[model samples]
Target: MASSDDAPRVFQPLPGRTVDRSAAYHALLRELLSLVGAEAPADDEPRWQDRARLAVRKAVKARTVQGPVPEEWFEPMMRATVHEPDPSFVGHLVVPAVAAWGLRPVLLALLDHLDNGTPADVAGVARAWYHTGGAPEAEHEASRDLYRRYQHTALRRFVTLDDLDARRCLLPGLRLQHRSFPPDMHELVDQAVHLARTSDDDYLRHRVEIQTRLT
Candidate 1:
């Protein structure tokens, strides 16, 4: 028998206001966790993996966050980060709220998803990390290494991945915001481009242009 309380817990948005997008996102999160072999943390569990959530919220303006942020909110945001956060999700989360608050969460979130097997999404994370001001020296000692990893490990891994969408999203970060690349970086780019060409899909040919300004 289904518990009467379970229905509301599954459908209700954190903070008690009903938001269609939030509700749908919560449902999708549970499904993804099942697929990934992870389980939802109980309310009594320690949901925060680190101080990143605190740093993100503390940076927010007083007007936006009224009081102590409900803990359930972190479940969705942290889960989103672990999945190597999508560009739209990053945009919605970072640009509107956290990015303006502080770039620390941006860097922390990028750190969490370095090995998720999608080159473009990783690059997008790196791009957002840098755009929001990568690794302030006072805060993080290994900031430069993040960019190095993006070039050497994350973006370069595209050649080994078969995700067409990752390939499509690759061009934007590659073309924009790149100040330096390792000597063999072009070789990897050529290989990825070659793979895209062989597929002969127009969407595979898509190139995301650099934004002139943050939206």
Candidate 2:
């Protein structure tokens, strides 16, 4: 058998060419094995190999009208079909909350720019702000309600924070007010308050500065 490192690189179908089923299957298996070998280290080889196999199986079962499998489907298949949540799952949850707080002013500024028909470089900031911010009281009540709902929902399946400090790895470019879990929840709560204040301040500042200059 050829080593994974020597596996065929091209999977894209050539124009006006029909793919042979046997050849395509071999090519895909080689690619999958190569990806698994490249991503998995020696220490946890078996576990990663199992995950790769499961990912492939799930992808195959879920395949629809497939010629060559779209490459993007593979990673999501790996993540979604995995039996255990990766360590980054918690990190992923925390980053958005931290960003809602840490980037409140910038988001408000972006919204202000958007309202005035000015272009903003930060795409999705406005949408993130709306989803995570709004009226302070409403946002706070919404957070509390979500916490209650999650308490009752499938989120209870996950373990509680055993290592707060270890889990609170600061996401890039944003400074969270608190670094410890549980306590850092206050940082997320404070975002609504900051958004309310900054939205007002930004409105006044823009009116005095940009709008006045335009007038």
RMSD of each: 14.5, 21.6
Tens digits of per-residue lDDT, candidate 2, 1-215, equal 11121111111111111112333323443455454333322434665534444544444433432444444544332222121122222122122322333323323343333233211111112122223222244344434433232222211111121221111110111122333124635445244224323443333223223211221
Q: What is the TM-score of each candidate against the true structure?
A: 0.47, 0.18
Best of the candidates, TM-score: 1
lDDT of 1 at 215: 24
Clashes of 1: 0
Cα TM-score of candidate 1: 0.47
RMSD of 2: 21.6
Give every collision pair in model 1.
none
Can you tell me which runs of candidate 2 are displaced by over 4 Å? 1-45, 48-58, 66-83, 87-188, 191-215
lDDT of candidate model 1 versus the reference: 0.41
